[model samples]
Target: MRTEGDTWDIVSSVGMTALFVAAIRAAETKQPDALVHDEFAALFVAAAGDPDTNRLIDDPELWADSPLGLGFMGLRSKFFDDHFRAATEAGVRQAVILAAGLDARAYRLDWPQGMVVYEIDQPKVLEFKGQVLADAHATPTADRREVAVDLRDNWPAALIEEGFDPARPTVWSAEGLLPYLPGAAQDALFARIDQLSAPGSSLATDTFGSDVDFQQLADFQTEQMRDTSFGKIDIADLLYTDDRSDPAEWLTKQGWTTKAAPPEELAARYDRPLTEVLEPYAQMFNGMKYLTAVKPS
Candidate 1:
C-alpha cells in the first residue's frame, strides 16, 4: 500500500523539473544570459520525459501566474548553488541529494577533481534517471552515485550499502521533500542523517514557516496537483515544527551551526522584484524558509 507521502514524492519527482525549465527561461531574460546550471537540464528533462511530467510545461502555465513560485524556486536554486560551490571549495567532497527528484546537479556543476555526488530517490524514479542519462550518453561532472531507496525506509542502511563513506564530509539537501513526510518522520529523518554525517558536513533545506496556514496552502495546490497523474499528497501535519525555532536551530543544538534566510531576503539576493506576487507567501509560510546547518569541527 503506497502511502500519501509516496504518492506525493512521485508527483514532486515530476513537478520539480519545472524549476529547471524556469531557470532556462530566466537565463534567456538576462542581457547576456546569466546561466548558473549546466546544459544537462534540458538533456535530463528529455531523458526523463513522460506524458505527466511534460503536460505542465506544455500547458504554458507558470507556477504562479505572478512571480512567487518561479521567483521562489529561482532564488532558492542560485542560493544553494552558491552554498554547494562554497562547500566544495571549503573541502567538503561528498554531496547526497535526498529525494533526488529530477534534479540535474550531477551533470551541472563543475565539481573539483574527485568530487562524488550520491543521489538518493525511489527505485522507480532512480531507475528512470539512470536509464535516461545512459540512453542520452550524458556524462556526469562528478563521480555520480545513485542510491535507490525510499526516504521513509531504512535509507541510511541502503546508503551505507552503496558504499557511502562515514569518515568523509558530505553536503546534503532535502529540498521540497518535507511536505509529504509526517512530522514524526521529519524529526527522525535528521537524526539518521546526524548519525551518518561527520564533522564539517553541510545541509540545506526549505521549511514551512510559522505564518503559513498549511491547511490553506494545501487547498490551494490541491486543484493544480489533482489534474496530473501524480496528484497532491497532503501531509499538512508534516511541516517543520513551529515557534520561530527553526529546523536549522534544532540541528544547531545538536552540534550543527545553522544559518537561515527567509524568502524575502532570498528574493532580494536574486534581484527578483516579487513584492506583488510574493505577498501571500511572504505573509504566509513565514516567507518560505531556506536554511543551512553545518557540523562543527
Candidate 2:
C-alpha cells in the first residue's frame, strides 16, 4: 500500500520497480537481436547487489514467466528512443525525463551538440544513479542534470531552479510513470507540462488503456510473478489503478496534436510481433497505446 507522503529508496517499494525495469533492459541488452542496448542497465543492477533481483535477471526459467519481458520492453525502449532521436532531428535541444528511474538515455543516446537532458525523480533514486554511474566512470553524451525531487511535489520550481528554460522547445518523456499517480494528479501533471512547454515542444509516454480492469490486471501480474522474488511486493499495492482520462485524449483536449501507436504496430514495426505473447493479456491491454503529442508553434 501507498501513503500520501510516502518515500522509497533504490530497492524497496516503488524504487524496486525501477530496478525491475533495469533488469529487463539488462536482459534485453544481452540478446543477439536486442532492439535497444542499454549497457548501463546491467551496471545499475550490479550496484544494487540484491540476490533475488540478480537471480531474476540471470535465471532463464524465472525471467521467462515475467510479464512484459525482453521483447515488449525492447520494443518499447526503441519507440521512446526513436522519439528522442526525432526530437533532436527536429532541432529540439533540451529534454526532460520524468520519473527517470534507472534510465540511461543521457549516457547511452548520441545526443546532439549542446543537448541538455534533465532527469527528474526522487532524491535517493537520483543519488543512487549518480553514484553508480560515477563509480562506473560512465560519461554522458549530453549535458545531463538531475532534479532530485518527488513528482507529487512542486517539481516545476525545482526544474526551473536547475536552469530549465521554459522558452525553449523541449522534448519531455513520462515513461512508466502515470500509473503510480492518482487520476487527479495525472491531469495536474499534464497541465504542468503544458504550462511549461514552449511552442514546438513534444512529449511521449506509455499509458494504460481505458478498458483495463485493475483487479484482473493485478491478479494476472501477481500470479505470473508468484514463484519469483518479485511476487513478495505486490505491484498492485503500489499502483493507483483507479480509472483515469486517457493520456492521448487528455492531451488532444489540451490542444496538442497527438498521435497514438498500438503496441501490436510497434512490435511488428520492430519485427517482434507480440500476438502470441499478448494473447493471454489481451483484455488488460485492449486499448493501450504509445502516445506522442506536439505543441504547435
Best by TM-score: 2
* Residues 96-196 of candidate 1: C-alpha lDDT, one tens digit per residue: 89888667788778899999898888777777667767877888989988998777788998888877997899898887777556566777788888888
Candidate models: Cα lDDT each: 0.66, 0.86
lDDT score, candidate 1, position 276: 60
Clashing pairs in 2: none
Residue 193 shift from truth in candidate 2, angstroms: 0.6
- Tens digit of per-residue lDDT, candidate 2, span 186-255: 8889999999999999999988766666666667777777765566677778888666777888889889
Query: What is candidate 1's CA lDDT for residue 275?
Result: 49
Task: Give the Å error, residue 125, model 2.
Answer: 0.6
In model 1, the runs with Cα more than 4 Å from the true position are: 1-35, 43-70, 222-246, 278-287
Quality of model 1 by C-alpha lDDT: 0.66
TM-score, each model? 0.80, 0.95
